[model samples]
Target: MNKTILLNNRPNGKPQESDFKFTDSDIPVVNNGEVLLKTKYVSVDPYMRGRMSDAESYIEPFQLNKPINSGIIAEVIESKNDSFTKGDFVSGMLDWKEQQTHNGKDLLKVDADKAPLSAYLGILGMTGLTAYHGLTEIGKPKEGETIVVSGAAGAVGSTVGQIGKILGCRVIGIAGSDEKVDMLKSKYGFDAAINYKTTEDMTKAIADATPKGVDVYYDNVGGTISDAVHANINRFGRIVVCGAISLYNSTSLPTGPRIEPILIKKSVLMQGFIVNNFSDKFPEGMDQLSQWLKAGKLDFSETIVEGFDNIPNAFLDLFEGKNKGKMIVKV
Candidate 1:
């Protein structure tokens, strides 16, 4: 029997694990041009929050009583497609099931030896590309400039900070816990890190960390932290608005200080983008990320929850700030 997780109901505010229901089904049969996959790892990302609601967004909402899907790394157990062979590893945005039958054209066959199979769901995959395209295209960080990243301990933010360091910028990270703060400074090569959950004055904390004023702001967690960043932005600063994990669970629209004044005063350029906006450049991004990974310039790590049943709790953990990096479920 194959177990799949489905969204049982729409969340009211903060999402609970009970919102997900597990259904047991028979393994899907492969058709011509299709391959049967057994999931090895599934990515649980923050962006899925937007898909859960019926509200308008770039992506369509997930249908009720259906399986929720994200990136997953799987192995081809049976192949009807000539392009894929049994035992080949592949990655794709397929259903949230233990076994799936997917068209071969929709999957990218990944080299298990080139990088760990799990890295396909993290650094060498969507998260890394999101950081790269957002930083290079929108944020436009320059050498010797001060860059600050919010939610700096998580998947996208962690990669953003390290890539900033590689580009010769001073990077400061704001996270929730002291442990994450230490990881940012010591392991992720951030110049300074602040634990916002304990900080008395976030504005002052940010100012203290980036003494030169923030030149590039890669925003992941928004709200008060964004207010502070806008208040202290350098002249002609650039802001790449990424995920707002801070406001994802809000039932009502979140209200905060207006930012137009700072935008005008600093001549800041603020842009919001999704990773697929640069889909044409994915190969280019992946090549650079792969080279960097081989050269030890980029580090990819994960906090994996074992078993298919834990997927929903792992997804909810993103709201709780429980994940250290890319959160995945191993089945």
Candidate 2:
């Protein structure tokens, strides 16, 4: 029997464990051009939370009474496709089930010996690509520039900060907790880090870090922290609105410091982007990231929960800021 987590209903505000149900069914048979895969690791990203809602977005929302879809690293158990054979390792979008039979087109065989399989779901996966595109294409950090990134200890945020350091820029990170702030400075090599919870004045904290003002702001948690960053941006600064983790679970729209005046006065460019919009550039991003990972120039972390039943809890952790890096479920 293959166990799966099913969406019981659409979530209201924060998602509860009761919103999901665990079910079991027989392993599916592979069809032509399809492969059977045994789940190894399943990524629980913040974007998945948006999918739980029925609102319109770049991707289709998760339907009520269906298995939630996520990026998964798996081992091939059976293959009806010539492209893949038994015992191959792959990463792609797969159902949150113990075993999955799906079309092979979406699956990409991973070189396990080169990098940890879990990385294919993280640093070598969607999150890493997001950081790369947001930083290079959107933020456009220059040498000696001041770059500020909110949610700096999370998966995408961590990558952004480290990349900023590699580009010879002063990187300032803002996270939810002191420990995350420490990780940003110590492990990720961020020049400065601020814990939003500890700091009463966010704008002051940002100003203190970037005394010359920020050139690029890679925004992950959009709300007050973002507004604070906006308030201190230099002329012609760039803001990449990657993911708004703060507003994802809000029952109401959050109000923050008025930033339009700052934007107009500084001529700051603030743009929102979905990673999928840069699919054509993904291969180049992955290649560059892979080289950096192998050269020990980058670091990444994953807070993994064991068992498929923990999928809902893993997702709930994201909203609470309970996770340090990329949160994944090991099924």
Candidate 3:
């Protein structure tokens, strides 16, 4: 039997374990050109919170009473296609199940020897691609500039900060906890880190860290921290608005910063991006990230919960900032 997590009810705010139900079903069989996959790991991202709501967004809402969907790393148990064989490792958008069937064309075989299978759900997957495109295409970070990233301890934010360092820019990370702040500096090599929870004045912390002013802001959590960064932006600074994890489960609308005037005065450019926009450049981005990983210039981390039944809790943790790096469920 295959176990799956089903959305039992829509969440009003922070999701509780009761809102989801675990069910057991027969393992799906593969047809021609299809592969049967046994899931190894599943990614839990902040963006999934938006999907929980029926409200309109870039992606379609998850249907009620249906198995939750996410990116998963799986090992092929059976294959009907010549391109893939039994025991092959692969990654793709798959249902939240212990085992499932997928078309071989839709699944990308993973090179386990090059990187861990979990990396496909994080550093080499959508999260890593998002950081690469958001920082380069939207933020346009330059050498000697200062770049600020929110949600700094998570998958995308950590990648953004390290890329900024590689680009010869000073990187500042904003996290929710002191432990995350410490990891940002010690593990990710962030130039500076601010624990937003302890800091009374966000604007002061950012100003003190980047005396030259922020040249780029990679916003993963849009709220007070983003407003604070906006207040200290330098001339011609660029801001990339990515996921707003801070506002995802908010019962009320998050207040915006009264810094529109600053945007004009500093000639700042702020833009939001969805990584799919750069799908054409994915190969190029992957090649570069792979090279960096091989050269030991890039690092990645994952907070893995062991069980397919734990997917909901893993996703809920993102809203509470409970993860230090990429959150993954080991199925």
Candidate 4:
């Protein structure tokens, strides 16, 4: 039997285990031009929360009682397609099922010898590309400038901070705990990291951390933390709005301190973008990230949860800050 998960319900706010339904069916058979795939690693990202809702967005919402899909690494156990062979590993947006069949249109072949199969779902995949493109294209950091990252311990945020450091910027990170803060500085090479949960005056904390003023703000968590960063943003600064995990679960519209006045006064440039916006440059970004990884200049972290049944809980753990970097489930 092939195990599968479906969107049991549209989550009201924070997603619970009940929102996902587990079921089993026969393994799909390989037909001409199709390949049978066995899931290897599944990725859980904060952005997926938005897709759980029925509201229209950049991507279509998962239909009620239908399978939920995300980035997945799978092995071609049986192949009928000429482009794929048995034993080949691939990565693509795939449904949450232990086994499935596809025509192999969007799947990209990945080499385990080059990088771990799981890394293809993270540091070498969309997560890494999001960080690379968002920073270089929107944040546009310069040497000697200070770059601040919110959600600094998670997959994209952590990568954003490291990329900022590579660009010669002083990187400051805002995280939920001291442990994550230390990991930011010691593991990812962030210049400074603040535990926002412990800090009382966030604006003051940001101001102190970036004495030279914040030139680029890579925002992953929005809300008060972002407001604080804006308060310390320098003239002609740039803000890359990659995500708003802090506000993803809000039942209603979120209100915060006005940012227009600050933006106008400082001539700041703030832009929100998705990874697909720079799809044309993915090869370039991936090449650079791979080169950095090979040179030992780039490092990645992961909180791997074993078993396919744990995928739902692992996803919920993202909101609770349970993972240090990319969260992956080994199936």
Candidate 5:
């Protein structure tokens, strides 16, 4: 039997656990070129929220009453595929289920001995790749430049800031809580961090932290915090617009104070990208990230939730800013 979660309902604004349905079914028999897998760890990301809606977007929305899927770490229980054998660890796009029978070509065999299994679903996987592309390709940070990353406590943001430090940039992280601020500064080695939730006069706070002005902006939370970053941007700034999690739950199109004047004034270059946009460069990015992790120039954190029953709650908590780094569900 396999337990799976389905998208039971669509959300109007902020989602609830009621939007998901948990049920059980038989694990399918594997055919040639297919491998049967046992679910290990599943990642819950802000982009998954976009998939819940029926709107037209870069990726198709999750259909109602169907299995919800994302990046998952799994173990092969049976293999009819020549590329895989029983007991091999794998990571790929798989459903929120206890088990899966997938085409071998769709999954990548993971090196559990090289890195922790959960890492393949996070820091060494899609999340890490996102940071690499966002920083190097778009938000090009030169030495001594002040780079600001919003949502700096989350998985991708943390990685971006670390990479900024590696490139000799002064990194400033903006997170929701004081504790996350501390973690960003103390644990992640960010030059400075701001507690967006507690800070009054956000412009002044960021100004105080980056007196040189923000030369690179790795935007994650796009809303008022982004507005604050623009208020202190430097000339020829590079802005990488990644996930706009702050407005993910907005029922209507978000209207805000315009930022065009700021961009023109600073000659800022702003680009919005999905990780898939840089697929051709993935192997290169992964190799660099792996080497950094091994050399201890990089680090990661995870707020792991136990049990399949908690998956929905874990995902919902992301919008509320509950997790410190990558949020994963261990089944």
Candidate 6:
């Protein structure tokens, strides 16, 4: 039987277990030019929260009763396509199902021997590509400059901080928990880390951390945290707007301090982007990330939840900030 998870309802605010439905169906059959895939790992991300809503966005919203898809790493258990063979591993945006079949279009073969299958969903996949492109293309940190990353302990944020350090920038990270903050500095080499949850004054904390001022702000969690960052932005600063997990679940439009004055005064460059924006340069990003990973200049972390039934819970955990780095479900 193939266990599939679908969008049961459009989440009213924060998603609940009731929003996802699990059903059993016959395993899919592979036709000529198709490969049968067995789910190995599933990635649960905060950006997916936007896709759950029916609002117009960069990507289409998930249709009700249809399979909810995200980044996935799967094994080719059976293959009728010459491009793939049994035991081959592939990574792509696949459905949240135990097993499925594909016609090999857009699917990229991955090697487990080089890195674990789950790595493709995080460091070696879209997550890493997002970090690489956003920082290099928009943030553009220079040597002796200061870089601040919101959601610093997440997959993309942590990698962004590491890359900043590699490029000779002083990096500061903001995370929810003290443990995550510590990981950012000690494990990922962030120069400083602030626990936004415990800090009384975010703006002051950011100011204190970066005495030189923030040249680049890699924003992942927008809201008041972003407002605080704007308070300390430097002249000609660059802001790479990524995910906004803090406001993803809000039923009403969020109100915050306007950034127009700050942007105009500082001549700051702010841009929002998704991984696909850098699709043409994925090979370049992958090469740099892999080289850094193999050379010990870069590292990654994962919170792996075991069991196919636990996928929804694992995804829900993202809003609670319960996972460090990448959150992946091992099926």
RMSD of each: 0.9, 1.0, 1.2, 0.6, 0.8, 0.7
Write down the lDDT of every candidate, Cα atoms only.
0.91, 0.91, 0.89, 0.95, 0.93, 0.95
Residue by residue across 99-178, what tens digits does model 4's lDDT show?
Answer: 99999999999999999999998899999999999999999888989999999999999999988888898999999999
Cα lDDT tens digits for candidate 6, 1-331: 8999999999989999999999999998789999999999999999999999999999999999999999999999999999989999999889999999999999999988999889999999999999999999899889999999999999999999999999999999999998998899899999999999999999999999999999999999999999999999999999999989999999999889989999999999999999898889999999999999999999999999999999999999999999999999999
Cα deviation of 308, candidate 3, in Å: 1.7
Give the worst 10-residue stretch by lDDT in candidate 1. Answer: 292-301
Off by over 4 Å in 2: none
How do these models rank on lDDT, best leading?
4, 6, 5, 2, 1, 3
The predicted structure with the larger TM-score, 2 or 3, is: 2
Residue range 75-178, candidate 2, lDDT tens digits: 99999989999999999888888998878887899988998888998899999999999899999999999999999999999999999999999999999888
Clashing pairs in 1: none
TM-score of 2: 0.98
Please write out the lDDT profile of model 3 over residues 1-331, one tens digit for every residue.
7788888999998888887888999888789988888989999888888898999999998888998888989999999988899999998988888888877767888998988899998999999999998899888888999999998999999999999999999999999888999899999899999999999999999999999999999999888888899989999999899988778889888667577798789898988889999999999899889898888989998898987767888888877778878999887
**On a 0 to 1 TM-score scale, where does candidate 4 land against the true structure?**
0.99
lDDT tens readout by residue for model 5, 153-262: 99999999999999999999999898999999999999999999889899999999998999999999999999999999999999899989989999999899899998
Selected candidate, larger lDDT, 2 vs 3: 2
**TM-score, each model?**
0.98, 0.98, 0.97, 0.99, 0.98, 0.99
How many residue pairs clash per model?
0, 0, 0, 0, 0, 0
Error of 4 at 132 (Å): 0.3
Clashing pairs in 6: none
Clashing pairs in 4: none
Candidate that beats the other on TM-score, 1 or 3, i.e. the better one: 1
lDDT of 2 at 41: 94
Model 5 TM-score, 2 decimals = 0.98
**What's the residue-level lDDT of 48 in candidate 1?**
95
